[model samples]
Structures are given as structure tokens and as C-alpha cells.
Target: MNRPVFMDFERRWAISGLEDLTGHAGEAVLPKRDFLARLDELSGRVEELGERFGVALGLDHSVFMGRAAILGLTRRGQTSCNGTCRLIESGDGWLAVNLARPEDVDLVPAWLCRKGDDPWKAIGKTARRCSTADLIERAAMLGMPVAAIPFSRHPGEGRDPDLSSQTRRLSRLDPGLRQDDGLEGGRRPVVVDLSSLWAGPLCGHLLTRIGCRVIKVESTTRPDGARFGPATFFEELHNGQEFVTVDFATPDRLRDLILSADVVIEGSRPRALRQLGIDRDEVMSQRPSMTWVSITAHGRDDARVGFGDDAAAAAGLLAWDRAGRPVFVGDAIADPIAGLTAAEGAMASLLEGGGHTIDVSLSGAAAWVADAPEIASW
Candidate 1:
């Protein structure tokens, strides 16, 4: 297998398409012919690999071919398509194209890998089931760039080397801590979920799974992107799940909720709480044992607005163009990473001698996978 050659070409192929849009003038638009040409190139490679995988599994050639073609077309410029799309027409271009006029749209190649089954099950199933080399080989057969697909969250966001090392230090508790340990004794757990989007909700969902009472706070004053953005709200089918809601208005209401919470996990800028009148210090002061967590695109303290896609690209967790265009990670890393980190911090604090505050940055969490060579969670 020409693995190196294949990867080199694939990377160039991916980046070139993204870079093509770098100089797109405010008035210039991607010509349909040019866009289709790139799509054809990506589709051809994908279908060829799909055929090979289909044959290996003794499936009908046409079945896999159809799936591959559909997948390929979707990756191209189609609105209903999935996988990845870099260089989306933004600014005037985005605003110019009327959603009612679908024919005028254009899309760039973005890598998307749809799982055959549940991703979590895939994680556990893949573990001890195949070597990285074997997995990479399979990914190649299926037309996925396994090496390019990021596995870790930002550095130290969750279970990075620092975290692993810390956990190792507590090796005395090796094989001792339970996934559900606080269920006893009327734990009266409180989760202040400030995260939005699927990943954040999933994190809170998981906490609710372990009997944590979760209260989600939002406001029309500063609406969550998911509520305002159509792609964010309805693009994915998982957005329909129910979550407890609270408007971040009225200091007394905020205080009442804060006094009730044991853990607060927020997926917003640092000091955002204070802006909303829910200051961390004030909350902690009110409830000395409270645990506060903040999640963001960049690290919480940085003067950057790290949206999930851009931060994922910057952190190397998602594909990026040679000219620095972004390919959003398949999974929203910030949401899940922050959620998991917040959950872990909550758990740690619950087990701690006292209360404390934690800040989980999406960028830092995204870098955690590759920074440590020996540990292989990726």
C-alpha cells in the first residue's frame, strides 16, 4: 500500500480545495463547474475504496457503490450533504445567496466519516479489537484519513498526560473509583450546564444519567447560537432532546439557582457568568463548596472568540487547509471535551477535600491527544 503517497496526495487534495477560496473576492463566487470538478475527484477516490471494502465484506458491489456516490455528492456542494465542507461562502457571499434559492449554492470538500454504529460502542469495540495499523488500513480501505482524523481533545482539557499523570498519582485508587460513586447518601447533586449544542447537552445528559439534577440556563438577551442559527439548531437530528431551561435574568433567580447547584459547567467565555450577574466568586462565596467550570473555543482567559470549528482547526483536532482554512471536527470537540472535563472536575471536586474552580478551554483540550506520545487514547 502506498500509504505515504496516498496520504500526501489526499492532504494536498483536501487543502487545495479549501485554499481555492482564500482569495475569493467579496463579489466573486465559486463557479459551479470548478466546484463539481473538485467534487468528482474526491468522489472517485471514495467510490473506488468503497468498492474494495464492499468486496471484502462480500456485499453487493452496487450497494456500496450507491452509498459511496451518495456520500460523495453530499460531501460536495449539496445542502443535505454531510461529512465536511470547507470554505463555505461567508460574509456577503453567504448573505447574498438566498436560502430559498438552493441552486446558487457552492461547497468545498470536507472529510466526513459516518459510523456504521454508535460511536461510543465503536470506541469500546475498537479498543483491544484492532491495532492502530490495522485500523488505519481499514480506514484507508473505507476512504477515511485515519491519521488526519483527530482523536484527542485540547491539551489538559480532560484526560491528557497531565490528567493521566494526576490520575496515576492517585494510583492508590487504581481500579477503585466507580463510574457512579455519588449515588448514595442523598448526594443532592447540582449541574449548572452553560453548554449548548449537541456535545454540551450530551455531557449534561450523561450527568443526568448518573442521577445529577441538571439545570440548563439560557436567555433571549444573549441567545445560544443553536437557538438562532438554523444549521446549529436543526442541521443535526439530535437537537430535539429536552433540557431544563432557565433565563439568565434577575439576580435573585440566578442566586436561587446558584445556591442550589453543586457544580456549574459553562460553555462560554470566561467572565461570561459575571456579565450575566452570576459571578464565580460570588457564587462560590454563597456556597463555599460549589464547583465552577467554564468552557470556550480558546482557553477561557485568552482574548479570542474560539468558535468550535475554528478552534478545532487551529488545535489540529480537525483538518485545516494549507492556507489555514478550517475543516470542523466531525464531533463538536469543545462541547464534549468541555462537558467531559467539567464532569470530571465535578467528580474530582466532589471527591475533593474542598470546593474549587476549573476552566476547560476547547483549544487546550483539543491539543491533549497528540502532545503526549506514549499515552494512546486517540
Candidate 2:
């Protein structure tokens, strides 16, 4: 079989998608790294589940880069920005911004303190006026999703290189069963997706492909902003799932909604969940067999907020352009990587049948991708 030509991003596809995500070794064009070869090994265990239970739980590595090529399969002449999400200049360094939401368009004017009919032009003009630090600080304060790409070939966030991309542990136990929740192979697990945008939703998407009954629960006040992105792409990720809207004001109903799931997928910070009257500890303690998958830009242990591309860059998953500038590896790469990684862990926990939690950090996954040697130059 001929391998897909990833062009500029062939290297990351080689590492994160190929070598790391799938333990396939062969004659390839891109460089390789052991940046936790075991990270994607969780996918192998899923194969075991399929064989043991007689289900078709196969994983396609190509799907991991859906942002780059999935939309190309359509007739549209590419939606919005050109490929690679527009790497622009900041006063000090370059920062990555994904206007994944309609509200984010309004943030550009507020960020620059200037008004313009064109969002990109206004963002470009405003970026020239301030340093990367200033823009990041201002974006953080305004709740705007933006990140600065670092030139040093590391994530803008300084996390230890040795940090594992995911944490899967037996955090709690089901009082009901000290046993494998035997699957009939025809059973569909329930997944409650409380995440928006890419990462967590992608995890839910992957789960649905494997016969999981996924329910995408969004807040009525603040729905998934990704609904404003390219229609085909959004639909591709959210297809084959039931969608529901809930009011965060009612904690009892929210708790019941999540508690009903066999697995829970979420991306908010801890306090944000608490504010909505949802606590992982309480939920897991109550139902130890529920697998809670928490996707954070940082980690569940920390409350830092981040978007996919910026957090990946901060975690150091970027290559330098010929001009020696840090370039975003691909479209919000950490989102998909963390999504795939988290899905693997979530599936394992579900079959194991325990109240276990998987902490899938976007920065950690990005760092795993960035830890590889720069791919071959074009």
C-alpha cells in the first residue's frame, strides 16, 4: 500500500500518527522517535477487546489528521484560512490563533482595541502593535483562545520533556464488581461528551465509530463554539451521535446526565466543572465502574487554560520555517493527538470495568510530538 504524502507535515504524521500512534515499523520517508512508543500501545489493547468480544474496533491512523485532509475530500475550495491555520507575527514572536467560535471574531477587535470590518486584517494589525507576551496576557484575560508559538523549538509552556502524555490509573473501584465487565461484543457503551471544539469531541467521535452510543451534551448558554466552523468538518466529527442541550443552572439534572454514561468525556478545568456542580471525584466515587476521560490543555492537576495549537506550541510541538521561525505543526494538532490518546485509555478503562480516570493533557501530547527530531526539510 502506498503511504499518504503529508508534504510539510509528513514528519509529525510519521511520529505522532505512525510510529507513536501505530507501532508499525517499515521503510518510511520521515524521521522516527521513541517519544513514548508505548503511548499508542493502548490502541493494541483495543484490538484485543475486539478479538475477545467479536467487535470491529479497528483504528485508522489516517483519521487522526482529519483536520488536514478530511475536508479536502469535499468539493469546497477550502474553508476560511489557508492550510496550517495562518502563522502570523507578534511583536516579539509569533502566536497561533484559531477563531473556532463566532464570539472569537468579536474578540479580535477587543484585543486590538481597534475596530475593523475584516477580522484577519484587524488581528494582523493588532498583532504588530503588541508583543507576544502582551497579546497572550490580554487574550487570557478576555477568555480569547490564542497562543504564542515559541522560537526555541519547545512548547511556549515549559513542561518537563519526560512527562508522560497520558495518565491511566485505577483511581477508584466499583463496589459492585471486582471483575472484568464482560462484553457481549454487541453492546454499545454510552459516552457523555461534555467537550466542545476538537479534542474531547474527537474522542467521542472515535468511540462512536467503535459502536459507542455517544450523547453530545452542550450548555444552552454556551454551546459548542465549533458549530460555527466549517460545516462539513464539524458534521464529520459529530456525525452518528445524539445531541442535547442543557442548562447549567440545574446541577441535579447535569449530574444525572453525566452519571448515566458508561464513559465521560470533558475538557473544562476542574473549577469550571465544580461551578456547574459536577465533580469527577464525587461521580467516580459513586460509580467506580464509570470511566471518566478528562481532556485538558494542561492537566487535570493544574487549572491552566489553553487552546489546541497554542498549547501544543507551548508544549513544544513545532518545526522552524526556513527563516528560523516556529511553525504550527498542523491544524490544532494536540487536539487530535490527545483525542486519540484519550480514546484509547477510555476504551481500556471501560472494558476493565473500574472507576478509573485518564488525564489526557494537550500540552503533554504536543510535547510528545515536538520531542521528535525535526522532520526532513522539503
Candidate 3:
């Protein structure tokens, strides 16, 4: 009579002890209390990280919503319209939320994910562009969970500016002829620049007015700052401009895009480029006719990590600190200047018959002014 009592109890309490099934036999489900506790721990960790990294998580109870709510918003044509909520699901659950801002260029995309052991895990995302794989990977290596997404101007799924004109644009250019000086008819050359952040993308923007057909590529993985970053500069309008960065669906696709480019530029360090299978020599070898440009804070060997402004400041071009303490420059000047320099360099190399690798260092480029120290007598 008592033998049947244990079997009945076990069947009724199946969701009781999953985390601690040590020697209890068959698979056991973790108790709801334990699961919730684990989730809380993860959320707490995320908060800790937010504080440490100067990031604004701002996640609270109201910020936590169901998957249905997110999908509803997407269907109703509101991606970044969520009023502070995080979607969560256990086993086979997934959540999708639009990252696009109202006045912006619909840069952000929906994110999809299944709950993992950790709370704030990003399985995947969809956006017009993301930050950058290198940046994301570096952030991840430093303990951040970042995902990339892809967004297009195509008119589909209730999206505006639908249908990417990539093919159409490609069709307009001469197939075999190389682009010259980025200015043929005194109009900006159409450049499909798929590089993000500083360096490469900045080069494209500078060349945009110089007759370069620059189409800043973006995906869920890498978004331009003009739309997704802090409310500053061009992004301050909240128009969600998608040109703040470059993006790609896959590395292979990005490579193909690069192959089609007359001048390919990047800001990654030598080591980073090598990791991405894009060493200067390799790129020159692969194309043998294209101009490959790479920019960095320091030369190829220096381990200095930098952003355009920081690099420019470090190189003493933008100006010293805010207090004017004779400190290093404090704005992001390296990227623009370096990008401009690279474009001209590419143009020069092309004019001289291409097949050259240009490595522009923020420090070196900015030092051009310092080269004549006598002018500092003022």
C-alpha cells in the first residue's frame, strides 16, 4: 500500500527539483522558485555591468514584457516603441522587438532569442546595421552579450523605403572600369560603404561630396551612430539616420562587397585585420588592383586602442583637455581626418596605377602638423 504512495507523489511534483537532481534518478525539472531566483541573479549581474560600463540598462519590472507584446508592437509598426520592457521565455520561447526609433532611418531591427541559462542572453537580432563584429566581439570578450542584425530599405513587413536598390545601383556602374578620383561629373561617386564607426565609413562620407557614390551599409550587427547611438550630432534629430555605420549579412558577403569596391578602408589594427582574414598584403594580393587602406590609433605594431576622437586627441590634433591643461585632444578627430587622408591616398595610388596598401595611423597622420614644431612658437 505504501509503495504506491511514493510513485504518486513523484508524478505530482515533477516541477519541483530540476537544479538538484544529483542522485534522484530520471530527469527532474528545476523548481519555479529556483528558476526565478536564477533569473533575478542574472538581472542583478546585468545591472552591475551597466554601472561599471557606464551603460544604461534601465531594465525594471515594467520593462519586462511577454513575447506577444513585442510581436504586437512589430505588427502595429512600432519597433522601438516599447515602454521599457524585456521579453523572456523558457524552453522553446522567443521574443522579438524592434530597435528602430520613430524619427530615425529604421536602423534597429527585431531581436529573437530563446531563454538560456543566463537571463540577458541575445541569440540573434535584426537591424539595418549593428555596431561591428570586431567591436561586438571585443565587448563580448570583455563579458558582454551582443548580437547583430540586418535591415534593408526594402518595402516589406510593414517597413518603409522597402526594396534595396543594391542591384539597381550596381547595374549603373561600368562593370570592368575602375572608379576615378571619386569625382567624374562633379557629383558624388556612389560608394556602397559597408564599414562601420570611424575610419572606413568616415572615408566614405568625406568622399560622398567628392563624387563618391557612398551607400553606407548597415545590418543588425552594426548600426551607424547617427541613429542608434546617444542623442548627439546628426542622431540628435532622432530621424534614425542609417548612414552612421556600415553593415553586412555575413563576412563572406562583406568580402564580396569589398571586392567590388575600388578602394576598401578600415580602422582595425593589424592584428584585428589578420584575424578577420584581411591583412593589407592579403587584400592587395586578392584584388591586385584595388586600393586597400587601413587606419589605426598607432602604427601597425602599437597596442593602443582608440576611437577617432581619442586617437586624434592622443596625436595632439584636436586640442588638449576641456580645461586646456595642455593635455591631449578630447574629440574624435582621428576618424574624419584619417578617413579623408585615406581617400586622397587611395585616389593618388589609383592615379599612380593602383595596387597599393595604405596604412594611416592616427598618430602619424595627426603628426603632420607637429612635424613643423617651430610654428608652435606662438
TM-score-best of 1 and 3: 1
**Could you arrange the candidates by TM-score from highest to lowest?**
2, 1, 3
Cα lDDT tens digits, model 1, 1-378, are 445644454344344343222222221122111222322332343233223222121212221122223233222221112232222322111100111112112110111132433332333333334343444344334433122222232333322112221111111112123344344665657776767654455455545555567777665465455554344332331232334446666656666766788877677664666777767776788789887766655554444444433333334443333333333323333344444444444555555522677666655554542132221111
lDDT of each: 0.41, 0.65, 0.38
Compare the candidates by TM-score and give the number of the best one. 2
Off by over 4 Å in 3: 1-192, 229-249, 317-325, 328-330, 375-378
> Candidate 2 lDDT, tens digit per residue, 1-378?
123333535554454543222211122222333332333453554455444434666655554556656544211111111222345676666667767557787777887788899988887887877877778778777876676654523345332323343332323323233244435543677899999889899889877876789999998898898887678778988999999888888867778989899899999988899998899999988887888898887678655467776676666565443445444444566777788777767766666663678877887766655665433333
Please give the clash total of every predicted structure, in order.
13, 7, 48
- Please, what's the RMSD in Å of model 2? 7.1
Model 3, 1-378: lDDT tens digits are 644644444443232221121111122221111222322333454344333323444433211221123223221111111221122121222122212223211211122223333222342332112333333344324322221112111224221211121011101112125333233344322344545555565455434433345555555564655443333332221222224333433356656666776666666667765665555676667778776666665556555444443343233332111222121121233444455456556545544445766667755554442232221111
Which candidate leads in lDDT? 2
Q: Which consecutive 10 residues in model 2 have the weakest lDDT in total?
A: 73-82
User: What would the TM-scores of all predictions be?
Assistant: 0.49, 0.71, 0.43
